[model samples]
Target chain A: MKKFEHEVIFCIVNAGFSDAVMDAAREFGARGGTVIRARGTANMEAEKLFGITVQPEKELVMILVKSAIKEDILHALYRAVGLNTPGQGIAFSMPVDQVVGLSEAPIEPKAEEQAE
Target chain B: MSEAITKKEKTPIRARAARAPRGSKRIEQVTAPHKLKLLFTIVNRQKAELYADLLQAYDVNMQMFLSAQGTASTEMLQYLGLGDDEKVVIASIIREDLAADALHMLEEKFRTIKNGKGIAYTVPMSGTIGVAVYQFLCNHRGDRV
Candidate 1:
C-alpha cells in the first residue's frame, strides 16, 4: 500500500462563514482551500436535538493540507465553526492518493520578515 | 515575475506523467482493476463548465460544481491570473484509471487556455450506495455499463 502525504479536509458550514473557516485554517499553516456551495439536509429532529436552526444554505470548504498539520487544522476549524457556534459546521478529512497542478512554492516574505 | 510565469508555463510537464489516452486501447483494460475515485478538479469559475464537459468523454457521468474562494496569497493569486479570487470546485465521480486521462486533458487545457490553470487530485472511494447508482455515475457512454 502507498503511504499518503496529504489529506483533503472538508468543512461544511452555514453559508457566508467560509471566510471564517479559511481564516482559522491559515493560522495553522494551511495555504488555502476551495469552497463548494452546498445545502444542509438535517431532519428536523436532529436540528431540534442539537438546539439550533439548521441553515439550508451551506458552504463546503475543501482544504488540502499536509498530513502533519491535519489535526491542528481540523481542531482550529472546529473551534471556529463547530456546532456550538452559529456557523454550526462539521469537519472531516479524506486521504488523497495523487495531486497535480498545485505546488509548494515558497511564499513571499511578509513586510516585517523582509525588513529583518 | 518572469520566473513565476516560467513556472506556470512549465506546469504541464508535471502532468505529462499521466499517459495520454490512446484510441486503440480498450477502456476495459485500464479500468478493470480500479474502482471509483473522487476527482476534485478546482478551477476558475469561467472554465468549470468546459472541464465538466470534457470529463464526460472519459466515462465521468456525475460532475458537481461548488462556488469557491482560493486561499492563495495575493501575489500568488495575481500570478495565477485569479485576480477576482472566484473559484469553482468540480467534484466528479471518475474511475481511477480514467481519471488519468481526464487529468491529462485538464493539464492540456491549463496550458492552452488563458487563466485556465487549475488543481486536480483524487481520493479513492471505498463504497457506493447501490450498483445502479454506481453504474450511472461511471456511465461508459452506453458501452458495457
Candidate 2:
C-alpha cells in the first residue's frame, strides 16, 4: 500500500509526432512514456472555435513522472508541440496515487554506517 | 407573482430549445446521471491482446491500443528480463462503479499470470458531451442509453 506521488501527463498531438514528445520529456528528466493511437472526434465547429486544425489521426503520449518535475516536463512538451505549432497538441497532467513495475532502488548504507 | 415568475423562467427554456438546431435536441435526450473513468494499461506488446481478452470478460470493451517503448535503462530492463522496451498501451472508458473491480482484476491478472507484469491505472473524466457520445466511447450500443 505504498503511495508514490506521481503524475500522468497526456499530450495529444497529430499522429507520428510521439517521438518529439518523448524527446522533449527526456530532456526534462522524464523516465519514459506510452503512446496510444487515437482518432480526434472534434467536429468542424470545434476546429473553427479553437482556431486550430484538428487532425483525425492523433497520437496520445502518456508520460509518468515524479510530481516535482511534472510542470517542467509539461512546459517542455508544450514548447515542442503546442497549439501554436502544427502539432497543435494539448497537454494535461493527472494525479497518480500509486504505481508498480518500477525497479526497486538500490539500497544505500545508513549515514552512521557510512561514517564508520 | 410566483406563478408569473415561474412562467417567465419556463418560457426561456422552451425558447432556447426551439432556437437550438436538430442536433442539440438529440443531445439533450441522451444525458446520463453518471460520469465515466478512463482506464489505461501499459504492458509488453505481446501481452496486449491477452489483456484485451481478459478485460472483455468483465464487460469492459472498446479498447484502443498503441505501441510504445519503456524509458527504463537497459541494465534495469535486463535485470527484469524484459528483452526490449516495446510496449502496448490500452485505453478504455468505463463506468465509475466498475473502476475498482476493473483495477482489482488487472492486479490479480498480473499476480496470477507470468506475463502479467505491467502497470494499469484510471483517470477520472470530468464530463462528457452527451450520453450518445458517452455510450459510443463506452461501447454500449443498447437502446437504453
Candidate achieving the largest DockQ: 1
Compared with the true structure, what per-residue lDDT tens digits does model 2 show for residues A37-76? 7898888897899896667999888888888989999999
Docking class of 1: acceptable
Instruction: State the C-alpha lDDT per candidate.
Output: 0.83, 0.78
- lDDT for each residue of candidate 1 in B11-88, tens digit (9 for 90 to 100): 885555345445535433554533899999989888889889988888887888878877655667689885766888
Model 2: interface root-mean-square deviation in Å: 3.0
Candidate 1 local accuracy as lDDT? 0.83
Global Cα lDDT for candidate 2: 0.78
The parts of candidate 2 lying over 4 Å away from their true place are A1-4, A12-29, A36-60, A78-91, A95-116, B1-32, B75-82, B132-145
